[model samples]
Every structure is written in structure tokens, then in C-alpha cells.
Target: MAAFDELDPLSGRKVLVENNLTFHDVTEAVAAPIEIPNARWWGFFIVSVMMLGLLLVSLGWLFWEGVGIWGLNNPVDWGWAIVNFVFWVGIGHAGTLISAVLFLFRQKWRTSINRAAEAMTIFAVICALLFPTVHTGRPWFIYWPLPIPNQMGMWPNFRSPLLWDVFAVSTYFTVSLLFWYVGLIPDLATMRDRAKTTTRKIAYGIFSLGWRGSTRHWQHYEKAYLILAGLATPLVLSVHTIVSFDFAVSQLPGWHTTIFPPYFVAGAIFSGFGMVLTLLVPLRSWFKLENLVTIKHLENMAKIILVTGTMVGYAYGMEFFIAWYSGNPYEQFAFANRAFGDYWWAYWIMISCNVISPQLFWFKAIRRSPLLLFIISIFVNIGMWFERFVITVTSLHHDFLPSSWDYYSPTFWDMTTLIGSFGLFFTLFCLFVRFLPTIAMAEVKSVMPQADPHFGEDGHHE
Candidate 1:
């Protein structure tokens, strides 16, 4: 309620375009944070920077000590590092979903939030990359993936899922980056045109590629964006599928299931939208973007979370049934261990967060209540992380060899490194909103009615 005061002017209407905001107002609202960030923005920025500092310090310590500083043992050699990598990667999925899939389907509501979601995808991928890089321990020689000769001159096993990850993740990052940057060109041009300082003008101009908003420019922009969306849509499915391959191809009982690909994809979008909700709810409130990022927009995203969450829950249930049906005792134990064994806490937390909490969206009021929506989003994020933890650690810790079984516990460095990734993500995001327009000003304009277009006063738009 405190942050969403801007919505009061709309009375009781629900539309993609709200409050009769002029194009000037749209551009100015988004640009204002970049031009003159307030104290609250500074507070968030500084906190994120501090977390980024933690990341650097922890990474430095990790580099000095090696992966041994982590709580990796014979049973759980793959620890939070892999879990964090998948978690971050999954978080990035919602961006492409919003930017590409929805756009391809002509969902105009995406216009208001796609820019920030796209930025979030980029930042989330950056964080995802950090874990696997450092997880190698000898990150300096990480270039072994290149076709060139290394110290040993032995080529990496191309069959390795790790290698697949190298290609899958790199491709995802490259395409997502290009997609995000292409979308920014017009907005960068707007900033350049608005610039009062020569330095700012030059900086924005260089990136904007001399975008003149001409008919030809718009035509080319639309074509390039469409092509990139086509490219990115499949990457959304493939990237996470490949990431799941890191487990699915393994002989481990819990990981070897065929269900992992679609399951992880569903979970990824589930968590991705959860993160989008977490960030945007507060952002729209803080920046007074309620008109642009309307309740309907939030509700649409909530519906996605609802659908995906249900898909994820179904996948969870099917995994248990598949295990039992296989008549493989090891597989049976793997699923049972997840629920009733050492990691039961993580399993139930995942269930509550990913499965149960999203059910609240069935109630219209809950989806529309920003505070309630934000709260559930937090749960969804927490639950998704626990889901990854359960999937990674539970299966590994209690594998076939009972003698090798050991409880996994993260060391201080491990915890710090995991927490620090958030710092990197938020720091990038803080800088993004502080410099770039958070909302797509150009796209939002297309949705707004120029005529006396207050929502049909009869409440039909709702």
C-alpha cells in the first residue's frame, strides 16, 4: 500500500495502459531514476555494492584456498556451487519468456516490464556463470574448453555434460546479451537525445548506433528484434534442458530420470517469474510505475507462476511414481531419502514454496494484493532454491554406497560465495535501473490510447 499509492488515481480500472499517462510522463518516469536517483535508490545500490564486495573477497579467498574450502566430500562433491549455478540459470529464464515468447504471441502487456526483465536475465546469467567458473577450482585454466592446446594438451571430453554446459550456457549468454542490447538501442537514443552533458551524449550515442527513429530504423529494428526473439525462445528451452543434462546424464538414481528436462524447464520459469514479481512489485511501487506496470500485468505474471508452479508440482509427484514404478531399489531409495531422510527439511520446503504457496493465486484478491503477491514471491524464490538443494545434495549425499554417505554442510567460504552472487546480481541491477530506462518507454506508447481513454468507466476493461 505504501509504495503503490500511484495506483489510487485510476479508481477501479484494470488495463495495460492506466492513469492517462502521456508519453513524456512515461519517458521521464523511467529516465528520472537514471538522471537523479533518490536516497532510497542509493541505499539499495550501496547494499548491493557491499554484497558485490563480499563476492570479490570470498572469490579471492576461494581462489587462494581452492574448492577444498567448500564442504565437498566423497558423497556430496557437488555442493552449493552446482545448485547455485542452476538456481541462477533458472532465475534468468523468465526474462526471455517475457521478452521473446510473450512478444511472439503479441502480448502487449509485456511492453511495460520487458526491459527490466531482460536486464534481469542478463544479470542472472552473469551470476550463474560465476559458480561454474570458480567451481572448477583451477579457474585460470578454465580456457581448456577452447579447442587450443592446454598444458597437458589433452582435449576435454566433449561427451562431458560440463562441456555441454560450456556451449549451452555460452550460447545462451551471447544470444540473451544481443537480444537485450538490441532492445536498448532505441531507449539509448532517447537518452542520448535528452542528454545535457557532452560526455553523456557521446556515451549514449555510441551505443545507440545513431538511431534516428525513422521509418527505416523502426522497420529494421522490428525485423532484428523478431529474428532474435525466434532465436532466444528455443534457447530458453535448450539452456535449462542442457543444464538439467548435467544431472540427467549421470548414472545417479535421482538424476537419471527422463523427467528432468521438462521438469527443470517448468521449475525455471516458475522461479523466473517469481523473481520478476519480487523485483517488479517493489520497483513499480518505488518508481511510481503502477500505471505502466499495472495490476493486470502483475496478475498475468502471477497466473504464469501459478501454471508453472503446478507443472513443477506435478513433475515432483511423477518423479516419485516413476521411481517406484521402475522397481529400482536405488531409485526408490533416492526419492524416499529426499522426503524422509536427511534432507527432508529441504524437500518439504521446496514443496511448500513451489507447490503449495502458488495455489494462493487461485484467489483473485491474493494475486491483486501487491503485498501478498510480494510475500508469496519470496516464498517461491526460497522454495525454488531448496528444490535445487534437494535435487543436488539429497541425491548425491546418499547414493548407492552407504559407506560413502555423509551429511553435506556448507563451509563459511561456501556460504559467503553463494550469498555474494546475489550481491553481483543486485549490483548489476542497481546500476541498470540507475542508468538505463527500466520500462520499455517506446513499446509502452503503442498500448496507450491517445483519445479520452480513461478505462471504460463502466468497468468493462477489468
Candidate 2:
């Protein structure tokens, strides 16, 4: 087992994983929270439920009163609901990137963070779905966007970007859920085997599908996982690309741009990683998982934030440059209005938080500091939200006609609903962290030399 000590190939330093951890240690550490609930877990859980209740209350009032309760008006019909929709959808991308794209590239570091990231992806999508459902003001009619047959004889407009979003998001969520659950089966089986009580054993056994850890079962699991990863990699790109289409395909001056697909995808990854860091920083310490989710892992994620943040900043500049270069008066005015109009503050907030703050990661000290990284990640989240706000509100507020130009502000219901969405996200995340393996224990073990048959007893390659 000593021969299994992970080493950084570049600097030859010991890697982030603890050298002495065994397979049993991984199982016990991951399963402990499930078998035993602590005060801290319950404390967070209760808070999340309260927030979720707020969401329910807000929605109930929204349904009872109507969409008129929102601050939406003639020019700005989108308001905060669309802004939040885009924000939450963008935040889901990082998990798919980590779980699928990185897996296809054979990046071993993903093992430490992929489980939580995938779970975040699923939860974020759930939150994202909520806004559009409620935005329709008739949650019961939500299925109208789907291609199902109806008595009205009107099928969904296949050419509509909104319809594209319906298909894209649903497909992404389904694939992500399957990918996440498939990965969990082996770990669930491990829990089932280790369960002390019959109820626990039976519950886990059902979800585990009676996994026996046989060589053939592993072969099938690996094949299915690889296939899903292959399928999901394209989805990681397509889901957000289609999402950007909701804006880019429109005739709207600020949104209709060739650069949106790549730009939105980059911003999605940036925000997603920010959220991953924000959640994991506290989680690592809370669960005493510092040894597994090492500073190197944190550093790697920060580096990603730096790179994507730069890309997003460049996109910001490019949008302005193109607006000016195109010589289209509407586009030019739209970009200028964003920078110097009524919502100018929001534009600057987006720039400062998304572009400037992420630059701090260039410092090795900051990248390695969990506290600073966590703080910066929160800033990135705020900035990304503001970015959506600036794009959605600023563009629509001052379109072509001055008569249609109107100021947009979220009502109390809007504010509460948005906050409630966070509650929904955190509730799901808390449940995931509590019951499931926060880390991919099987994958982590597979990366260790101790799991390799070819390694010699003398701590040398055979």
C-alpha cells in the first residue's frame, strides 16, 4: 500500500491524497454521514427547508395573484425571472464539464470532485427549471411547450428557440441524472454491504440493484459509464449553446450575436466552477475531507476559474467591439446603454466581480487559499447573476421606441422566489452530501497504485 502513494508528476511532490487511506477507510468516511446524522447537518437542512418553504409561499402567491405582481412591463417582459433562469442554467454546466468532458479526457483529478459536481448539476437544473415554469404564470400549462399531442391541435413550434430550450434542458437533465445514478450504484452497494441495520441494508440494496462487485459487473459498469460520458460531453456543449440560442436567435440587438454560444458556454463553466468552489470549500472542512480534496484540487479549480473568467471578460470586450464595428445604430446604442445607461451599475458590477475579482487567482497564494478562493467564488456568483441582469434588463429596457422604454425592478415576490430557488438548490445539495458518497470512492481507489495488480511488492513497477 505504501507503493500506492500518489505523486505529482510535474514537481514529484506527494499528491493531495492521503498516503495511508485504504478502501475501507474511503467507504467508512463517505458512509458515516448517512449512518449518523449530526447537529450541523440538521442545522443546514432546516435552513434549506425554510428557504424552500419561502419558494412555495412565493409561488403560491404568484399563482393566486398572477404575473402582474412582478415588476415586468412593456419593454422589459423578461425581468429577473429570465435572468435567474439563465443564471441557474449556466451554473449547471460545470458539473457536466467535470463529470463528462474531463472523464472523456481521462483527467484523474475529477475523481475527487465529480460526484458533488454532478449532483450540483442536477440540482442546479432543477432550480433553473423552476423559473420558466413559474414565469408562465400557469404551472399547469407547463407541458404546452413539449411535443405531446393536445386537443388544440397545435404542436409546439419546432423552430422556436424556447422550444429548443425545452428539449435541450430536458435531455441534459435526463442524461445527467442517469450518469450520476449509474456512478452511484457501486458505492451504494458498498454502503449496503456495510449497513448495520436491516432497513439500511434493504434500502441501499434496492438502489444498488444488488451489485456484487464481481469482475463482470465492473466491466459492465465501466462500459456504461464510458458510454454515458461520451454522450454527455456533447450535451455539456449543446445544452448551453441551445440556451444561448434563446437570446442569439432573437432579433434583439444585444442578444443576437454570433459569439453567444461560446461566450455563454464559457460563462456557464466559469459560474459553475465558482459555485463548486463555494460549496466544496465549506464541505471539505466540515466533513474533514481536506486530505482527499486537497489544496491541489482547489488550485486546479481556481486555475479553471481564472482561464474561463478571462474568456468571459474577452467576450465582454468583443461584444462591445462588434457592436461598435458593425455600425448598426441599434446594436451600438444597446452596448453603450449597457455601459452608461440606467442599469450601468449592474454592468460594472458584472465586470468587477466576474472579470476583476477572478484575476486574484493569478497569485499562487490566493489560488491555494481556500478562504480567499471561497470568497472570490461568491463574488463570481454575484457577478454572473448581475451579468444576466445587465444582459436581459439593459437590452430590453431601451429598445427601439422610447414609448416602450420602461424601468424594470423585481417585486418582493421576485426577490423571494429567487432566494427560494437557492433554498431549493441547497436542500437537494444537503441531502446529497448527507446520504450519498460526496466523493467517488471507487474511482478514487482505482487511481491508487494499491489497486493495480502490476505494481511489485518492492514499491516498483513490475
Candidate 3:
């Protein structure tokens, strides 16, 4: 086809994909990673397993001794475990937002990143679920949170916010898993048809569900995907809303606030997109995917980070405003103490990273620079974790009675457990990239110029 650099007055310039690639080129590019094993992948996978091992060891010791191994104090009953839980849960929000919410709205840019983002969502949620179970100090009794009929007449209290977490997160994970799986079927069929080995053939064939790419198959797939997308869009809002309830419903001075729902939701999408940048930038280089992912996709995500980060900063200021406006001494002290008191260091870190760093994305160069975007994204992840820590630890460090107040500090075990959760997340992600097509091959093809019926109009094509 002849080169066409035509521009529409309305949208300026747009390129969801670069490099003038055809359908076969997209397939070869995406399938290269799975077809040829890389040494870098093995190294990444090994380190992840080591981290997973540490998590296992930490949990084993926790089960043997108790939750007392954590740095819990008189005033601070909840510690890093709860903070990590919230952090991981927030890290999962962007996946569903990109895949389900954006898909429903017909955002074409999501085609490149949505598959990997969905996998990240599943892994992050798995890491999030671990903390609540272990935090109870009895892994064996973890099932007590479920309603099981028994002669003792004991059942989970549905009224508890923690129980609501159980329901909300599980439902989010289930719907996300199904949605991700459904999207993968067409691509899995591609992998199945190309598999050379019996093991690969069997694995891909089973997961592909005998997809033949016929007219009937495409019809069912589109209808099913649309239905699942509709089902998943509400969950993007509801899951985080329920999570915020864990703090908002509390009577504690710092924790009691009405702004928590929207604030937490915005922060979740903010942090989740941060993580997507952090993971995708390096892989984009390692896998030679810059053309496919393109500067446009990265910039769009950066724009989102800037927008949500601003909302989060607004919430921060709003919290202080609400405290002062409420005329409650306890609420005022909580806000003041968080900013200027004992845990002041953590609070400022959250502000500088979450609020300040994302502002740099407002610049055209920084938003388009993959390296700079990666750095800021790292800062976003750190700031978001600190945000959760501040929300959890600062509020509990000093309660109503000063006599029972104390400074909260994490133990070595706390450090290990937190790092190990990263291990689990990366381990699953490494496996995903190795075995499956990280980019959605079919979706990417659909967005190409050759897929358009008007490609040869005016004899533009050779």
C-alpha cells in the first residue's frame, strides 16, 4: 500500500500502533517471546521463586508462632498486614478499568495493554487475598469467614466490614478471571494451531475450547465478551468502595470520613496504572515491543496517571478541609497530627511521590519518554504504598486515649512478608509472559489499517 500521512482536523495525529506492520507481523512479534526462550526470563523467574520461598517461610513461621510476630502495639492493633492488603487490592483496579471499562466505551488504545493488565489484576488479587487469611492468626480457621452449616450454630457475621471484603474481592477476582479467560480464547486458538510440541498443543487446545474462528464462533465470542464487560464495569467501582468502608465505617478520628469511597477509588486506579507502567516499560524493551505498544499508548496512560493523581491530591487537601470544617477537635487533631506529628515523614513521602511526581507528566517530553515514565511510575507505586501505610498506621498510632498511644514500627517479619507478596505477583506474571501471548494478537490485528475495508479506496493501495 502507498504511504498516507493524512490528518483529520478534528483529532490531529493518532497512531495506536507504529512501524507499518501487517497482520502476520503482529503475530510473529507477539509470538516471538513464547517461541524463543530468553535467559532474562529464566533469571527473572528464579528471583521470583526465591521471593515466593521467603513468603512461604514467613507464613510458616507466622502459623507456628502467631500474628504477634508482626509489629503490633497497644494502640495499633492492625499493622503492615492490613496495609499490604489494601495496597495490593488497589494495585489490581487498573486492569479491570483498562479492560472492562475502556472496552465498553470503545477505547481502541486499550487493545495493546489490556491483556497483560488483566493478568496483572489476577496476580495482584491473589497476593491481596493472602493477607486477610493470615492476619487472623489462624490459617486453619480462615474458612470460618464463609457460611458453612454446622451443629454449633456459628456463622460468619455479614455485618462485619472484613466479611464484606471477603465477598467483594472474591467476586472481583472471579469476574476478572472469567473476563480475562474469555478474551484469551481466540488468541489461545492461534497458539494452539501453531504449537509444534505435543505439550504445547494440548495446553493451548484445551484452553482454546475448540475455537475454529468461524462466523458463528466470532458471533458468540463477541456477545459473551460484551456481556462479561458489562458485568465487570460496575465491579471496578464497587470493589474499592467496599474496601474504603473498612476505614470509613470505623469510629476512629482519622478513619471516619465520607470522602473515602471516591478518594480510594481514584487512588486505586492511580496506583494500578502506575504498576502497569512499571511492568510494561521494561518488558516493552526486553521483548522489542516499542513499535507495537508505541509512544501513543504510553502517553495515554501517563495522561490518566496525571488526572487520577490530581484527584488523589485533591482528596488529601479535602480531608484536611473536612476535618477543620467539621469543628470536631478529634478530627482536626487527626489531620494535623498526620501532617506534622510523629509519622510526618511517611505523610510527606506520600504527598511528594503521589502528588508531586505525577505532575511532571503534564510535560509533553516526560509523558512520551518511556524511561522517565518508568521512574515516575516507580515513585507512584512507592507513594501509593506509603499512602496506605499512612491511612492505616497513622490513624491507629494515637487513638482517643493518649495513655494507650504509641508509635508503630514494622518488624523484620513484616518486611519479609511485604517483599514476598511482590514475589508471588511477579512469579505469576513471569509465567504468564512466558507461556501466553502478552499482547492480544487478534485484537491488535483488528486495529491495523489493512483490516479496514476502505484501505484501497482511491487506489491508495498497490
Candidate 4:
């Protein structure tokens, strides 16, 4: 075999595998957390559980008190709940973008981070799903949106974008889950074989689905994975596009723009990457996975954030331009009020966080610093939340009629419920980190230079 040594053209860094890690090393590194539990992990898990409990309490109170507990009223009918929904949904877009979109483009860098990002996508969707369900007020009757037969003879309005959301989000979640699980089979088998205890072996074996890693098995696995990736690539765009439709289909001035689809999709990916960085930075540091999840990977993600951030900024500008160009007074007033009205602070916050902060990534130094990347990512998350808030609340607060305009604010329950959603997200994430391989071991190994047959042990090209 020939051993080829090359440099990474982008970073001018050596492509040699650091520490000469092997396939066994990759498996052991990923499986270590499952085998040995740590105090930090438990501490984080406990906190997440406590937060989840808070969500449960808040939800229970909301059910008992009704939707009146929130800051919803005449003009501002949809409040923090819808805002949170859109925010979480947008945050889910990055996972499929990295996993399916990049994979289709033959991007190798995704191997190290795709597993956790896909898990984050599923968790984010779960949080997003909570908002619409709870907002129904009588959440138990949420099945009303389904086409289930009923004695009362009530069928869901298929034309409504709200119903469209039910289909879009559910389909996105199912496809993402299947893709993630399919990728885990080989790694799960590795875990099963390495397990010392019968309980662990049995559990992993069941999840592994009798994976033997034979040549025939791999051929089928590759085909299935590729097919799923093809299916998921469109979902990365379509899911968010349909979500934007929930607003665009409305008669509201600010909500009715055609730009909402592409704009929302970009913002979703932007926020999704930010969240991925927020979760991964601390995770890699805590687990000492810097070698695997290197600065290069973080930098690449930062570049994406910068590009998408710019697109979001452009979309923001175009909305204002369109408002004026349309010669529609309601649209003009809505856009003006969004930037200079009662919720002006929120608009600027969204601008600063989503548009301005990511510009720092243009500097290689900033992108290379984990602490800076983490901080900027947090800003992106906060900014994206405010973006939804500004869109949902500001548009509703000021309608065409001056008499109906009213200020809206979240109630105590609203604040708690939002916090609780974070708890639910983290709780699931912590559990995932503990039980499953946080990194795709097989994929990571495949990208390693040692896996290349053309690379010889003598460190020379064939």
C-alpha cells in the first residue's frame, strides 16, 4: 500500500492523523462515557431533569388555567408559544443540512459532528412540537388536527397551513430519526461486542439489530443510508419552507411576505449551527475530544454561520424594501413599527445577534477560539428567538386598525414554560450522550488516513 502525506489546502495544516489513532481508538473513545459515568454528567443530567419537571409543572398549570394565563389578547393572539415554536423549528434545520445535504455533496468534515447534530435536530423538533400542542389550549384534543374519524363529524381543514405543519414536522422527525439510527447500527454492534456485562451486551445487541458488519450487510447499509440521505436533503429545506408558509399564508401585513420561506430557512440553519456549536464546544472540552472535533471543524461551521447570517441580514433588508415597494400602507406600517415601534428593542436585538455578531467569524482568530465560537453561538440562539418573537408579536400587535393595537408581554407561566422547554431539550441530550455514541465512530474511522488503502505503512505513496 502507498502512504500519501498531504496538507489540508484550506488550513495549510498537515493531514496526518494526530496521535496515530486506530479504529479501536475511535470506538473506545466514543464508548467511554457509556461504560464510565462521571460526576459532571450526572450533575448536568440532574439539572436537565429539574428543568423538565418545571416544564411539566408549567404545562399542568397552563392546562388548568387555560390559554388565558399567557399574554395573548385581541391583537396579539399568538405570543411566546408560537415564537418558541418557530425558534425551535428553525433550530432543527441545521442537523439535516449537515448530515444529509453535506453528505450528498461528499463533504467529509461532517463525519465528526453529524451524529450529535442529528440528535439535536430530533430534540429541537420535540421542543417545537410542544408549543403548537400546548397552544391548542385543550392539548389532549390535539388529535382534532388529524384526519381521524369522529362521531361529531369534525374533519381537519386540509387547506390550513397549521394542518400542513402537522404533516411537515412529523415527517421531518421520522426521517431524521431513521437516518440517525441507521448510521448507528455498525457502531452499536461494536459497543455490543465490547460490552463486559450481559445486560449491556443484550441492550446494545437489541439496538444493533443483529448487525454482523459483513460485506453483504455493508452493501445494503450503504444503499439504505444513501436513499435516506436523498430523502432528507429536500426535507432540510421543505420543512422550514412549510413552517414559513404558516405565516405567509396569513393576511397579516408583516406575515404575508413571499420572502418568509427562504428567509426562515436561512435563519433556521443559522441558528441550528449556532446551537450545534453551543452544545459541541462544551461537550468536546468536557470529554477531551478536541483531537477528533478539532478547531478546523469549528471554523468551518463558523463560516457557515457567517454565510447564512449574511443571507438572513439581506432578507431583513429586503423585507423593508418590499414593504415600501408594494405601496401598501399596512405592510409599510408593520415593517416601520417592527423597527421603530413598541417592540423596537427586540428588532434591534435580532439584528445585533443574528446579523452583526456573526460577522466576527470573518476573523480567523475568532473562529479558531472555542470560547469565542461558543459565545457567538449563544448570541445566535438568542437572536433567532427574538427574531421569531419580533415576527409573531410585532406583526399581531399593530394591525390596520389603530384602535386594536395593544402591547403584549409574557406572563410568569410563559417564562417558565419557555425555560422548561430548554430543560426537556437538554434532558434528552444528556440521556443521548450517556447511552449512545455521541460521535459516529464508523464514519470518523472512515475519514481517518489509516483507512485509505492507498496509504502504505512505510509512509510512502504507491
lDDT of candidate 1 over 232-309, digit per residue (tens): 999899999999999999999899989999999999999999999999999999988877888878889999999999
lDDT of 3 by residue, 1-462 (tens): 113333322345566667677788888889877888899999999999999999999999999999999999899999998899999999999999999899999998899999999999999999999999899987888888788997789988899887998999999999999999988999999999989999999999999999988988889888998888898889879999999999999999988899999999999999999999999999988998877787778889999999999999999999999999999999999999999999999999999999999999989888988999999999999999999999998899989899999998999999999999999999999999999999998988886666776665775543
219-306 per-residue lDDT for model 2 (tens digits):
9889999999999988889989998999999999999999999999999999999999999999999998876888888889999999
Ranking by TM-score: 2, 3, 4, 1
* Candidate 3 vs 4: which has more TM-score: 3
- Candidate 3 Cα outliers beyond 4 Å, as residue runs: 1-13, 458-462
Per-residue lDDT tens digits for candidate 4, residues 1-462, read: 112334644345544234667788777777886788799999999999999999999999999989998889899999999899999988889999999999999888899899999999999999999999999989889899889999998899999998999999999999999999999999899889989999989999999999998989899899998899999988878899999999999999999989999999999999999999999999988887766787778889999999999999999999999999999888899999999999999999999999999999999889888999999999999999999999999999988788998999888999999999999999999999998889998888987776767665464533
Query: Candidates sorted by lDDT, descending order?
Result: 3, 4, 2, 1
TM-score of 2: 0.96
Q: Cα RMSD (Å) between model 1 and the true structure?
A: 3.9
Clashes of 1: 0
How high is the CA lDDT of each candidate model?
A: 0.89, 0.90, 0.91, 0.91
Kindly give the stretch of ten consecutive residues in candidate 1 with the minimal lDDT sum.
Answer: 1-10
Better model by TM-score: candidate 1 vs candidate 3? 3
Assess the local accuracy of residue 396 in candidate 2 as a C-alpha lDDT between 0 and 100. 91
